[model samples]
Target: MNYMDDFPMLNKDIVYFDNGATTLKPKSVIKAMDDYYLNYSSNAHRGDYKISLKVNDAYEGVREKVKKLINAKSSNEIVFTSGSTDSLNMIVYGYFKNKLNKDDEVLVTKSEHASNILPWYELSNEMGININYIPLTENHTVTLDNVIKSITPKTKVISIAHVTNVIGDVRPIKEIIEYAHKNNILVVIDGAQSVGHIKVDVQDMDIDFLAFSAHKMLGPTGVGVLYGKYDLLNELIPTRYGGGMNISFTSKDEIEYKELPYKLEAGTQNIAGVIGLGAAIDYINNVGINNIEETCDSLKEYIISGLKSIPHIKVYNENVEGSIVTFNVKDVFAQDTAIYLDKYNICVRSGSHCAKKLEDELGIKNTCRISIYFYNTKEDADKLINALKNENILEESLGV
Candidate 1:
């Protein structure tokens, strides 16, 4: 099924293959945000006025929507933040800082995004915790056997991305989480690339903490979610302390904070973005997540099959699951390939893709990534292939 009509960006005469970065917002998501700004513009959960109450309802409604989207135990477990980076920071400092000890260890893969790995790096430096990598297979994907061999008695946390942004390898999270739990370790999932493309059931997977962005999943920018189990999330201290989260404050030493989700949501939120996120979730549910995954899976296969015929294009993640296809055009620098593709009105991402440590595993520092979404088509792949087939690619991209 064609989703061209739903996204206004499709009319711009460009092939959008940078879905891993951010997706084009659907009309429904746009309309929802517009309606919030145009119809009822007021501070939520403040003032007893009618519009304020309406704003309160709409803002809080998105929390429930997110809870259902991931099948969390309660809406109380959902905490809204700026984006995945913000959410990961909160999870690392707000929750783990106090719980973890100096000698404790945290396990992560080199392929994780900066959002997932850097925070742990900061925490490790500050708290004297050891950070270790779970060895990846030859395909640059994680295996359950490797996870077992990496863990030690001091391994208190296992944090990794559900689907790596660069290699597009979907980790064996369920098996990893189960093993971690048996060893009394907590599992934190960076779901920025996984939540939108695949079905995420927090309960079934027994995830301890999950972070994701709204913009990557067809919602507005400046909004994201941090999902934690009730007891665990309740223990997380508020990273940002401000109004809308406190019940009472006497002197410097006396203050009363609210419960569960509200305690974490300090200060005024991105109300319009939250409402748009609700609409995006609605749009995905209407189209069915399974259908979206199927479309990407099939399109990825078709594109990989065609790319193999081109000698210069060295495709990475060909055997990996999900929609992302990583490659480089032999002697051409990744960024030059990107610039050349832009001339053809086809867009693709080229770089370390915020996974700088990934170079250790992939054996290359830079690559061009074609991350597909449900909205991309076979025609888009054809255009990319045709452009790569040109022998003058190096000279043309270099403007020589």
Candidate 2:
């Protein structure tokens, strides 16, 4: 039951709790990438020989793996990109920028990550579109009723995170997507924090588009997936063009593009990383995602219960679900608290966490964030709590 053994980094004298930022890669994922470089190292689609064929199979095979992971209607619907930020930009600039017009509205929440918020802001600025906010409930959860009330005739799209990275509120995305569809609005979900942790089905929810990162899901970094409906992807003009994406070119004036998936992939991709993502998915499937989810939930509950006993720690997301806990120690800077914990070899994220605009919403300048995965144990949480309980030690770092 010790999933920690799968991760080579866990062998060190460290407790990695910064999973929300990025997860520790498992040995299976590492071996998958290593096997590619050690055995068949070649570019995909551009070669016809033996090594090239293996690369092509791996490149295309990962697409199918992502399709099954999110339950997309077709393997063609999944497109590989650099990461979630890259995927969201593709949606905003490739699709929405061309489709939307002046005065059109895109509904989003203020609690969204910078990747989700900045792209929409640029779209609105350039296209003369409007970016609107959907009000959160009293507990900061994105409820369906609030979404219903936020809709207007000018609303063309609704973009939000499946789970907010800072607060860890699991939004009612399925119901929101259904409501948006009824109103003829497109829904773009930022699934960076939700996909690997929870069971996500794009087809069952009828999601128009979903973006997630590989590094957050026990996979290698520098790789991500962008899932879209077939018809909608067709409407998106490929932003990057050159190399393998073009089918034929007669001078600069005439060119024919490849089909879906390939058309979006401009150049040689991160072949090793994509292959590693397939291995990560295989590892998750073997362990069972449901089992992982249940384990993480139990650990989060235990951590929250232990944190409550400490009077100095102010815990946010206490009522929210998921494995992320955001809190601050009384009279201690978030970064300083993190440094104190680091002395004990407990790793956590501290800062605005790339969501700078979240300050006004949460009424705090910064927070210490602890995110757990299946590899974590009760001892890890106990060490963190014991560290916080040592006021004499923590106060020393206050001047830091």
Residue pairs with backbone overlap in model 1:
none
Stretches of candidate 2 off by over 4 Å are: 398-400
Tens-digit per-residue lDDT, 292-381, candidate 1: 899999999999999999998899889899889999998999999999999999999999999999999888999999999899989998
For each predicted model, how many residue pairs clash, with residues at least 3 apart or on different chains?
0, 0
Q: Which stretches of candidate 1 lie over 4 Å from their true place?
A: none
User: Residue 210 error for model 1, in Å?
Assistant: 0.3
Q: How accurate is candidate 1 locally (lDDT)?
A: 0.93
Error of 2 at 160 (Å): 0.6
Q: Give the worst 10-residue stretch by lDDT in candidate 2.
A: 391-400
What TM-score does model 1 achieve against the real structure? Answer: 0.99
Model 2, 108-177: lDDT tens digits are 9978999999998888778799998898766667889989999999999999999888888888899999
